[model samples]
Target: METLANLEAFMRSAEHGSFSEAARRLSLTPAAVSRNVAMLERNLGVRLFSRSTRRLTLTEAGETFRHSIGDKLEGLQAAIASVSADGGEPAGTLKVSLPPTFGLNYLMPLLPGFMERYPRIRPEWHFENRPVDLIIEGYDAAIGGGFDLSPGIVARTLAPAHLIAVASPAYMRHRVPPVDPTGLGDLDGIVMRYLRTGRIRHRTMRDAAGREVFAPLRESLVVNEPAAMLEAALLGLGVALLVVADVLSALDDGRLVRLVPRWYCDAGAISLYYPSRTLLPAKTRVFIDWVGDAFKARKLAERFAGSLS
Candidate 1:
């Protein structure tokens, strides 16, 4: 039992690269986490981590040990959860990661209902743009699009990530609207650059008739975040490519209008992502099912579908 505690501490410390971070996840003091790891090292007669003033790093032995035991921990946790099912009631912290604006605008509305239903399930969530490691970061789930499918992670698609060209009515007053996707090249484009890679991305827009053409717009203004790019478009800076879900309200209120409505870029799927656990925690399982139901009830798939006209 003491060995199990040490193993848990060691694994979390290795994942986060700090006893403090591991302690936070485990709800233990940093000193306790450090002591457990030291005890584990003494028992094994091998130093697991090389500590520095700035950070803690795993040693070669630690890496080997982690590789041998890391996956087994999940199995162990699943077994424990199965034995202590608490009469199938979902309880405990449900930690999740969500995209900033999308989570706020879309998901936040459904939370009151979820809370009312699952009174024992505490939601610990954060809004972040960057990709998160579900296992390493201790997140039960994440919701977003454009994540690389990593090992031990699975995604359930919720909606199509459809992007279309949009601009304020004021901006297009004197300017001629694009007759085709190719005509967008001549327009002043407010573009978003990839935040992590700092690379400008261009995509081919497809029309209802399946004709695809690449928009070769000159990037007059480049921004990283989508909100900023939308701001530029709203301020009549230029024609901007934006997610249909993000600007749906503006388009409806006549603040912004869709350009070349037949053409849209299929940016992939917005999905709910979780670790590929054989035996998922009841809290996580319920949340996944509940959210899926919510999306279906809201007709989010149809609403966020790629433009056909």
Candidate 2:
């Protein structure tokens, strides 16, 4: 019988397309994953992966094995979860990935309350500006922006996100405010580099009369970090297109002002992305519920309320 550890390694390697990626997900060295695969191959007397310099491909035998074992592994996982559910008070490590800016500005503040509410649940948090594969990375959940949930995962909207054009008071003093999104083309505007798709995105604005305007922007200064862009905007470098939650503090302090009020771009909903809840561990479920309730009670919901619609 194949060990559960080996089965998990094989599943992760197949999902991630590389041994190194699978190793990272499991918090093991690449050599360890290779050793596990080698042991499995030795036991079965058949090769699993077609080794190459650039890519890892599944061999015919490997594909057959995966098909035969996938359902069994899933069943075992379900069984384990069912048994674990009988024990009360979620006791396990819950891993969550989140966007750095949103995590810092919004989620971090509510964590203390969540911790207090669920003392037995320990959370491991990873914050990044790039997209992370939840299953491959062994994450219980991820909080993300503007993502279309892929198959085999569950997604819950946490808040609506509105994209607005903004500039520091000092920057606005030297330049005329853009009357609409299209007018931004004539001003010095900063464009943030979106890591998931490698696209530079901006909000298109319109006047109260519905006249179209573009925000003056160039793809230069392509920053992948939201905090860095916020800092640049605070220093009065140029106009920034940002989510309302990200710049809320600056706006309240009079450091930054919305370039065009009553006219903004809809960026879609910010949501929590996770694997299927059918077999989710108790700790993971508790964290998800806490996040949902916290967002409802926080100011983020109010900010997104009128704009997200």
Candidate 3:
């Protein structure tokens, strides 16, 4: 009988197109994944991959094998996960990816309680601004917005990914507040340059009653990261378009206040992304549920809506 490890190694290698990438997702060394693939190929007595320095292309037989085995293997994994359920505590290293600001502001507070409840589960977190390839990068879960839904990943929303205009109390104290988004251009604007596209964005905002307006800012200061832009806004440099999750506590504490509060941009939804519902490990499942429960207890969804509707 073929061992589950060998089959899994082969399957992941096929999916990721590189032994190194498969190793990352499997939490194994590349040599181990290579050897496992070699063993599987030997057992089947056929060449499975056309390996090159830069690419691992599937052979005709390999493609056929994958077509025949893909769903079967997924079902088997689901069955195995189901069978492993016991009335015991879940234990493992939970690897997660999160946006830095939101992680520090929101999710970090939930950690102490999570750690106390599941002492055996160790947390490994990566805080970054870029969206990650969860399956390829080997995250148990990721929390953010604007991530591509790769073949096997799923997203559960936590709150609205809404952007609202905000500025320091000092900055707004001297300036007349805009009655509408169109009037925003008259204010000093701290804006962000998108890292991926290298462009400054102007949003078309919507009011609660469905009025739309093209909002433009003066661009008095420009920064590449949200954290920096937020700091600039706090320093009274200019008004900023910031994500609601990034500024919730600041807004609550009076460091920042909403500008043109009735109008906001709907970027997307803040979400928790995990590999598969069927393939969830105990640690991952608990973490997902924990986040969902916390969001409910905190009423973050309602607070994150900039339209306040």
Candidate topping TM-score: 1
Model 3 score (lDDT): 0.89
lDDT of 2 at 124: 87
lDDT tens digits by residue: candidate 1, 60-157: 99999999995898888876666656566678888999988788889889899999998988998898887898877898999998776799899999
**What lDDT tens digits, residue by residue, belong to model 3 across residues 1-309?**
788888888899999899998887777899999999999999999999999999899999999988888667767765676566465687777999999999998999999999999998999999999889986676889999989997888999999999999999999887889999988999988988998999998889999988899988988898999999899988999889999888888988999988998899999999999987565777889999999999999999998998893
- Better TM-score candidate (2, 3): 3
Give all candidates' CA lDDT scores: 0.88, 0.76, 0.89
Arrange candidates by lDDT, descending: 3, 1, 2
For candidate 2, the 10 contiguous residues with the lowest summed lDDT are 300-309
Q: lDDT at 101 for candidate 3?
A: 96
TM-score comparison, 1 vs 3, better candidate? 1
Predicted candidate 2 versus true structure: per-residue lDDT over 1-309, tens digit per residue: 888778877877877778898887767898988888888888899998998987789999999998888657766776676677676667767788888888987788888988887887777899886667776568888888655467778889887676677788988886777655666667676777767678876556544455655555765466877788888889888877787878878888999988767666656778898888457777777788888987777756677532432
TM-score of model number 2:
0.79
Question: For model 1, what is the alpha-carbon lDDT of residue 26?
Answer: 79
Q: What is the lDDT of residue 276 in candidate 3?
A: 79
